[model samples]
Target: MKFPKVQLALVQMRDAGSKTASIAAATTWIERAAAEGAQVICLQELFATCYPCQAEDHTMFDLAESIPGPTTDALAELARRLEVVIVCPMFEKRAAGVYHNTVAVLDADGTIAGIYRKMHIPDDPLYYEKFYFTPGDAGQPRASVGPDKPNGFNVISTRYAKLGVGICWDQWYPEAARLFALAGADILLYPTAIGWIDEEKEEFGAGQLDAWMTSMRAHAIANGIFVGAPNRVGIEGRVEFWGNSFIVSPRGEVIAKANSADDAIVTAECSLEEMDVVRTHWPFLRDRRVDAYGDLTRRFID
Candidate 1:
C-alpha cells in the first residue's frame, strides 16, 4: 500500500478556564498548524472544558454535551474552512444519565466521518473517569447500529488518515491498540488529559512520564503503526499536567514532541508508507499466535 506523507498536528495547550476560551485557543493553534501544512489535527481530551472528574461532584456532569453540540459544531465549521481532518475529543452526554468520553472524527468537508467512544475508564484518585463515563462498547464490529448490534464501533476514515481513536486511560491498554491496528487504522491517536498529582510528583514523576511514553511507544512498535498523544499542559487544581505531547513512529522513535511546560502546536510529517516496510520486516502481525490466545478474553486465568 502506498500513501503520501501526512502532516500530523497536536494542539498542546493549557485549560483556558472555560470551554469558549479553550476552543478559541485551540482554533488559533489549529490554524497555525494548518498554515504550516498540517493535514490532520487533534486536540487534547475534553478540550472544550476543564478536566472535571477530579472529584465526584454531581455538577461536573453539566460539562457533558450531546453530539453536534456547541463544541462539535464549531469544530466542524473550522474543519471545513481549514480543509483539514480534526479529531475532537469530548465529554459526551449520550443520554440523560449516560455519558461517554468520545472522539468525533470530522472530515475535511465538515461531515462527521465517525466516532470512537473511549473503551477504557479509569477510577483513580484525582482521575475518577468511571464516575462520569460509561465504558465504551464496540459492539459487533463493522455492523450497523440495530438490535443485533447495540452500538458498533464505526471505522473512522478521513481524507488524510484512518484513525485509531482512544482517550487518556485507553492509551494504557495493549488490547485496544492491537484491535485498532487490526481494524486497519494507520495512526493511533490518544487524546489525553493525564497529569501528576501534587504529592506524587516528587516521588514518582519521572518514572510515571517515562512509563506513559513507553507504553504508547511500545504499542506503536508492536502494531507497526504511528502514535500521537496530545496531553494537556499547565496546572489544574492539585495536578500538574506535564504536557510533553508527542508523535512516535512505527519503530518507536519520538519523531516530534512538545515541551512539558507550555502551549504549542506540535507537528510531524508521517511517512505512511513506512508502516508497510516496517511491518514487513518485523512480521509481528504475520506471526501472531491467534489460536493460542483464547485466554486473552478472560479477566484472568484462575
Candidate 2:
C-alpha cells in the first residue's frame, strides 16, 4: 500500500464569537492535532465563522472572503510549517453577488490543492443555505475526479491520502459518497455543523443525531472506505451544535468518537491496507450496474 496507515484527526469546536477568534482557535487546534501525530486534519464546516446562514440577512455576506484571503493564507502557511494536510472550509465570496460554501484543501506544502463547493443546499428552518450559496455548477460533464470535474463531488489528492470531502448537507447523499469513492478517494471526510434547534430538541433530537451517524457509516460500508465526520459543539444562536465528531472504518464501525457537547479532537489511525482487504471481500463496486442508473440525474421520473 502507498500509505500504510494514516493518522486522521478532526477539530470539533464552537463559535468563538468572531471570525478572527475562531480562526485563531482553529489554528491552535491544528497545531495541537499535528503535534498528536495527525497526518491529515479536518476542521468543522465554516471554521472561521459562526454558522452565518441561520438567516438570510444581507449583512452575513460580510463574513465571506475569497479563497486566498486571510483564512487560507494563515492555514496554508501553517500547513507548510506543520507538514500536515488541512481541510479548511470557509464562506467563499466569489464575486460581488456570488458566494459559496467551499472547502479549500491545503496540501502539506501549503499549496491549495483543490476546492469543492457545497452542492446540496438545504433550506430548512435555521439551515438556510440556498439564499447564501449558489448550487455548484462550475464544471464540465464528469467521468473522473479533478478540480475540473463536477465542482461539488471531488476527490483531492493530498500528501497523506486522497480525500473525498463533502459539506454538512452533502453527507446524507449516498450518490455523492459513491462518486467520491469511485474517483479513488481513500477516505471520505464530511466537515459539518449540525444540531437540534431549541424547539425541535424534545421531539426530534435523538433520532436526528442517530440518522446523521447511520447515513455516514452506511457510506463507509457500502463503498469500502473510511469515513470521518467532525462536527461543532455548544450553543450557537437558536441551535446547539452537537459535537458528535467521529471516525468509522470500512466495515462501518466507529473507531473513534467525541461526546455530543464537548470541545474535542477526534483522532483515528486509518489503515489504507484495510481498504484493499475490505473492498476485495465486499466487492460492492465490482457488482455495480452503472449502465442502468441514468435516471438518477432526473428530478422526477413521472
- CA deviation > 4 Å runs, candidate 1: 1-3, 145-154
Cα-based lDDT at residue 223, candidate 1: 95
lDDT, candidate 2, 87-107, per-residue tens: 999999888999998899999
The residue-by-residue lDDT of candidate 1 on 8-127, one tens digit each, is: 999999999998999999999989999999999999999888999899999999889988789889999999999999999899988899998888888998888887788878999989
TM-score of 2: 0.96
User: Each model's TM-score?
Assistant: 0.96, 0.96
Model 2 residue 89 distance off true place after TM-score fit, in angstroms: 0.5
Clash counts per candidate, in order, are 0, 0
Looking at model 1, residue 221 earns an lDDT score of: 98
